[model samples]
Target chain A: MSRPLVLVVDDDILLVAMARSHLSAAGYSVADAQLGAEALDRLDERTPDAILLDIDLPDACGIDLLQRFKRRPELESVPVLMLTGKDDRESIVRAFEAGAIDYIRKPYIHYEMLARVGSQLRIGALMHELSERNGAMTRELDVAARVQRSFLPRVAEVAGATVAQRYRPTTALGGDMCGHFIAADGRLALFVLDIAGHGSGAAIVAVAASGVLQRAINERGLDAATLRGELSAFVDIERTGFYATLVVCMLDTRSGELQLLNWGHPPPLLLERGRTRWLSASGSPLGVGIGPACELQTLALGEGDRLLLYSDGVCDVARDGFELRAQALELALRDEPTPAAVAEAALAAAASETIEDDDMSLLVLQREAV
Target chain B: MATQVIGIEQGRLDTSSGDTLERRVADALAAGASEVAVSCGTLALVDSSGLGSLVRSLKRCRAQGVSFKLLDVTKPLLRLLEMTRLASAFEMEHSSRSGAKTSV
Candidate 1:
């Protein structure tokens, strides 16, 4: 790394020379400005690690100079030490109020100058490192957010079926995910899953769980019991208190038959002929020490039937500080022309209320009557 | 042997509160309590992480040969437990629907 640069502004040429000798000897690069204008020129040329401003300048007041330095966004965090001859309470307070971080009386010891300058340089280096880390973290989150977005089921043109999906993460990374794949048996298998938290940690778990679930689906086929057992093994290696609730549904387009495996998620809604039915059959969430095998719930869809699956975050929407009931959610899904419109209506209702605190995901599968 | 009771407040038992529950259970067990029961009268939400915390606490209790129970579970929480098949995992006391106020 390059050496820290210290800019010293003073009318006293002798004092400037003394400071430069001591600071340079102590491994800091020093710049001297005899006038306030010269200091501004130096700042414009390149940013320094710290500034030492003499309170009485040839062309400008040091307090005013400090304020000017602070006004520039790039120099706002740079430490400025005020050098003053007067030790009066008013001038010291004025220096501080004007944004000088520290005040040193004139004729100070050279060792004190070196010590304070060294300390401020150290602090500046640490702050720069912290800022860099924060930037890196933000970039990583953006990539993770993109990866999470890719996990969502894309609009597939399945014969005799219409599919729509919506996702909103409460943070840069969300704990919710939805995915689908065509099974070997020619059934369309889709799942909506929610991890236990909202953020990067939960997002990582959600992605990992998605991979594990996909592998399980490929190996276990459409057997809910076998898939649950496979996930149980995956949970053993996860963090002690990390788990995910999932709902997986397989639709046979040829027969209009739907098979659902609800693993501790909110019950899915089946809409038919202006009425709603809740498929409430559910088992323990994946990773809670395998209890009973999840019971597969089956439903035969007639023409123009709709199946809506969502994370609990969607149904937990509150209006005017009151949480809406599942029935209200079902009502939101009513009369929507297409799967996309159904998702939009529910999201609109959720947005009208207080903002949801969790990640929200919705998937709608409709059987084409025609 | 004394039975320790941990009352769950109105907030959720999600990722943020899971560690606290585990710590409370550890403290209770360290205090020589032979049994630990969580009272869920006002708990509004229990997610998968919350359930995992409970399962971890139950495992700890069993390793120490202590009994773990749930007391006064609300209807919504009961449904979650039942749906997750965790109702059969622990011994539950009188539930809120049962209208019985039994001590641990």
Candidate 2:
């Protein structure tokens, strides 16, 4: 509890003194600067809770000073109440245009001055408190994003294929998650999960699910069906109400035979030699207890083939329909045959003036077609 | 002024409408509607928020011991639900069997 501080910037000695005495008597700590340069120096030393700026200063135009003050990102929101002489309509209008939040005409009435100062102080305090809270929240989310990132595997060679992934969340933390597990028997198990909701809860679940499967898949090769079933059994939808559209596949790189199961996700696309094939949605998403009866399907991902797994965010790109999206995807793959290139092509179509519509994630596995 | 309740007509669900959609279904249940069915025939799109509303609606119905289901779900809406594996979350009267269409 110290009193709110006010910085008074004016060239008039008597007027500045009056303001300082009145504001101090009204429970405010006051500081005054006669020149605009002095006022700016005071500001650089430390930002006060509020500023009362005179519309005219001997050294510089207060309007110019106000513009400069507003330009600083840190002080953009601080309340600046312009002090204008009565009948100076142009100065009052110009002060506001330069970012003064409010103004009081001079021949400064003690009561009016105190009232304007008090109200501005309240708003300034509230804004400061809000920004502090937002800063703390952002820091916490950054840590959560880091933790979620750590659960994902490092980009490396799985069996004989080069594996790489790219994911972007709409927010600080997102629900879309992907992970790769290389089993003891050299089967590379890869999964891409998109949770139903966005933000912290979905992100937490995505990371947790990734961790669970990584441990389980690395222990003993869990077939695709059992992997989905075990994941479903592991969750209590009634309690957490969290479910994810995921596709998990085990690739035996040597033979290029991939055992795949997709629960409700966009099918993983398979690009081999000169042809392209879209993977179908073979089952239901996890956590709904839908008894999603899906049999494991085996597809050949021979040498020189690339398989791409992506979230539904990519599906939202095509304007006409799914057929258009498929055609675009196939062309991109045939042209470059790299996971990043095709994923980029899909995203460019989805790109709006705002730069994004939803979170997009891509995991690419390419078998060296020796 | 009479309160307006949104029925299952032609509203394509999105994040912006999720809360109102939740309240509308809750009100219908509160007013002693035995069974609530929403028609999704004209819905061209359903985003994550729209799906979120359906999940909440299902929860509210179970809590109030009333029945609620979706009707005439469009192919796009059904495809969205299927991809999310939410096809079994509701019982469809005109089950377009809208799901089960896979790629590749």
- The best candidate by lDDT is 1
- Candidate 2: Cα lDDT at A133: 100
lDDT of 1 by residue, B52-77 (tens): 77788888898899998887776666
Question: Which pairs in model 2 have colliding backbones?
Answer: A264-B83, A278-B104, A303-A369, A304-A369
Residue-level lDDT tens digits of model 2 in A1-370: 9887789999999999999999998988888899999988988887777889988899988899999888888678778998888777888888888899888888878899899878887887787799899999999999989888877775465558877677788887888888776777778888887887788988887887777777767765656655665566444455576767778788887888888777777887888877888777767666655536555788887777888888877764212275566676677666775666766776665453233556778777888754
Highest DockQ: give the candidate number. Answer: 1
Q: lDDT of each structure?
A: 0.78, 0.74
- Candidate 2 CAPRI assessment class: acceptable
List the candidate 2 regions with Cα displacement exceeding 4 Å. A1-5, A33-48, A57-61, A71-78, A233-236, A317-322, A352-357, B1-11, B30-34, B55-72, B82-104
In model 2, chain B matches the true chain B with a TM-score of 0.77
How well is each residue in A164-191 modelled by candidate 1, as lDDT tens digits?
8888998989989887677667778889
Root-mean-square deviation of every model: 4.2, 5.6
TM-score of candidate 2 versus the correct structure, residues matched by position = 0.84
